[model samples]
Target chain A: MPEMYFSDAIRAALDEALTRDASVVLMGEDIGPYGGAFGITRGLHEKYGPERIIETPISENGFVGVAVGAAMTGLRPVVEIMFMDFILLAADQIINHAAKLHYIYDGQVKVPLVIRAPAGAGRGYGASHSQNLENVFLSVAGLKIVCPATPADAKGLLAAAIRDPNPVLFIEPKALYGARGEVPEGDYTVPLGVARLAREGKDLSIITYGACVPLALAAAGELSEGGLEADVLDLRTLKPMDLTALEATVAKTGRCIVLEEGPLTGGIGAEVSARIGERCFRALKAGVQRVAAQDTPIPSATPLEHAVLPSVAALLAAADRLFE
Target chain B: MPEERLLSAYRKMLLIRLMEERIGALFTEGAIAGTCHLCIGQEAVAVGVAEALELGDEVVSCHRGHGHLLAMGGEPARLLGELMGRQIGYCRGRGGSQHLSAPGIGLLGTNGITGGGIPIATGAALSAHLLRTGAAIVCFFGDGATNQGVFHESLNMAALWSLPVLYVCENNRYAMSEPVCRTVAGGDILARPRAYGISAECVDGMDVEAVEAAARRALAPLRAGKGPAFIEAATYRFCGHSKSDKLLYRTREEEAKWRERDPLTLTRLKLEKAGWKETLPWIEEEVRRQIAEAEEACRRSPLTPPETALQGVYADA
Candidate 1:
């Protein structure tokens, strides 16, 4: 294993898929020559050529729907939306067509398309560009949502997403793209609906995913200093969620705090916590708590954005409050 | 041979008209659950374009898509079963009239949203190009869909990438109750595609032969992978937009004027003048028999069990 940026890990997974399958294609705005808005797909166009690495116009609705159609026929298309907020433009294609095509057609068609969108609010991109829309897609039944916290999981999860015979929404935390971690070299796939233990503990469980994983782990380390050990769980796949792992973790610790980057109301945290209450209520030492962003648009100013989003300090405080 | 081709197109169109009428009758009888958008008068566009398609060619149809599905060799019993919400339906009763798909016959699906299928059809063309399948894609949309942003975006992308897609806009002079003239800018719908640099043709959709000829010419360049093409079929929907529509938007005189140039009547007269008078009766008898069988099949197909409702939401999840 070698330490690599999360962005590089994604690129490596895409490169492996492209090499393995001739039908695998990359389509997105500025994903070819410009490499991508975040520079993740850099040099792929040169290596894979124009046919495989398609540079699309600023048409999210057009290109996303095209990916769905391409997937329906024979090709395995991985469409990249510049930002998670931009997925709103392509919602009909993703939610209505891509998600329902296989089921509505009674399993006649397979929409093997991966929609990669960079989400989360941290870099002061304003309300429009920096909102986490994963919760918006959680209600959509057929589509799978994967948000990787570690570089290794990012590579493995993305590889699996490309190979899966269904539509997958790969949400990359924009804040974590440059974060470095050890990723395996060769073919590896992190199965969807599986959770990874970021840190082992017995006091309580810090249930989280995506960019919040590191923050939860950091908060767990701080809590350990105060003689309280917490289990930090990284839920790689959000949809078809790893409730088995959740049960195990909750049964072990008997207390939990679900963390997310999106707004508090009707967010992923609410769903996870509700499930925890329903399934693991007998084991719970305390009610399931949710530490998430305030119900307000992510702002352009750094101070205001920090106030709106959940911070590592906030998680540490929440953990301390849980013990109290 | 020419007469046979014309007759085949005519038969498909007649099947659509009859099937839509039957579905409407079923809805009135409260046998059909969901509402339907009928393609009664605008049959020529679907029949003509479907006539031009080669085997394995795909189509993405819009909300008013019964005609397109029927023209693409869709099974009457399965389609009727779908509207009746039975297990034997094309979508197994999950998707009703607004969302019908028969991939076996190369129809992707009838989309529920306006202009939603345009990009999906473009993607199918992209797939054909990438897979070297040599199959073309025909996207059927309505006049209302032209206002959607994806319509313009899909056409621009298809043209720019040389995708093998023929965008067929059934400009039936109305978008639901709203007239197209008032909704669309400049009121010249054909100019939309021409602005995208894609070759566009305005065809008389009441004349199946004219539409078929226009489709053949438009599809030639598309099948050859030269580029995308657009055909604005000037047609009219004889019925109200949907089962809920009260027909309050337009005048009876306006409707009467369009009815005089009805596609079925136009095709019947053309066939009669071409000495194919006997063909109409024979075709009508065959269609009537098929419709009867389809109705029986619909009655026989069972409803899906409540326990299995959650199945097929995700495969191998």
Candidate 2:
């Protein structure tokens, strides 16, 4: 019943999880006392105490493995990697241990851990701080990848991820942290692997997630005036994608456009488009069009960054191609 | 130590030696898959440290972990089944010898990577402290693992948090073919942990009584929640590092010298001197029976079906 920004929604969800489950704890650099580099965990340390809200040193690998170990031993730990690029330091634990423990142990061990990382290019964080690596983890089998587009979805999906009995990579778009939305109070959850249809139209279906979701929505609105009604679907969970919804929408619309902020080559959009093409080959009127970033490191300047990443105009143009 | 405790320690060491020898034979016969690092000659470290632990206390072991698993009262048949890649094993054939686990026996897990288990052990100690379980964690690693960065980071965290963990370094003088002198800048591994402000001790790893006594003293602060402690057991590996490794690095004279201080033989002699009449024969027969049962289980255990490959990728989520 209250308006909440994406960051506030994360905080609310973490607070709710901490209150509901005593086993849940948060640990990361600058998460406690300083609230978090982005202030998402502000006031949590004071309320939950140091035991639950721990401030770890800058040992990403150590803390990440510690989180995995804790999760295996009945504790649910939410580890925050300060930047998405820094996750490479902890890749051994994330890829080798957390993602493979369940399979290697034959269901005997569960790495019920949630790793939150801020991704995407924006705010002049430069090349190092800005990179969309959802596809890097999407290829991994045991991990569940979720990128929420709205405050309400962030709160609901994060809550569900913490409670779910698997390792989840929850990537929060840094640019959307302050974006506000109407989020309900009290306990609420949206199941993973569900795609939300943000805007419904018959002309074209624009499937996207994370930062691209907002851009896609904006593009859908602009397309309405141009007499092309485009449907926008926000794929909140990327790993176990909502193939059912995608196929049904593409079948109905007969045209599709996949949008992603990462490089067009080997992006998640490729996999989504391929799957849709394979499933709805007979129903689709045109091949799936992709609106993605250019294949290069995110540039520092604003104009270059805009040129590289997918813009609302880019999505509108792609939708226009799909309709035409 | 008491006479009965001494005899029990001897029995445990004998069991580990026999079990590892059998495992080595299985590896030679091509019955075991993956890399198998046996703890054949380093039985005292496992038996001594395990004897010092309570029933609910936990231990995280290194790749050379058969002795550690057996010393903690693991079922020999199931362990052998695990090494043979059978579904009846502790990890259901998923984790072979290097990644074996028996959480029920307080053996948290054994890892293959050097120094990988240190942080997990630290986390387990932290969990015990938070849950008020009063259970101390015993982390066992080879001298090679001391070179890993996680070892230092975990020690610092454990000392800072005063978590209940006993860092046991089985300094076997060689990490694979490289001698400890070649790899370690500082000659002493115990001193490295001591620099982290944790209480440290160096003990004769070949002597079971000495290791047990040193472990008891080192674990006092950990049990009292004062902080963590470190023990560097100065031992030698009479065998090569793994099944494929040849003993080309060391001469036969050196191997014979360490074998002279063999933990099983020393414990047997100690038990005999303490008036235990048939200790050696009884332990030998018990170990023989265990080896036979383990071998039979290994032969009879079913291999993991290929269809269940994707199972447990996530815990029913």
Name the candidate that leads on DockQ: 1
lDDT of 2 by residue, A127-190 (tens): 9999998888878989999999999999999999999899999999998998999998999998
Error of 1 at B60 (Å): 0.9
CA lDDT of each prediction against the hidden true structure:
0.91, 0.87
lDDT of 1 by residue, A184-286 (tens): 9999998988999989999999999999998898888888898989999999999989999999999999988999999999999999998998999999887
Which lDDT value does model 1 have at B279?
A: 75
Clashing pairs in 1: none
- Model 1 misplaced regions, further than 4 Å: none
lDDT tens digits, residue span B168-196, model 1: 99998889989987999999998899999
TM-score of chain A of 1: 0.98
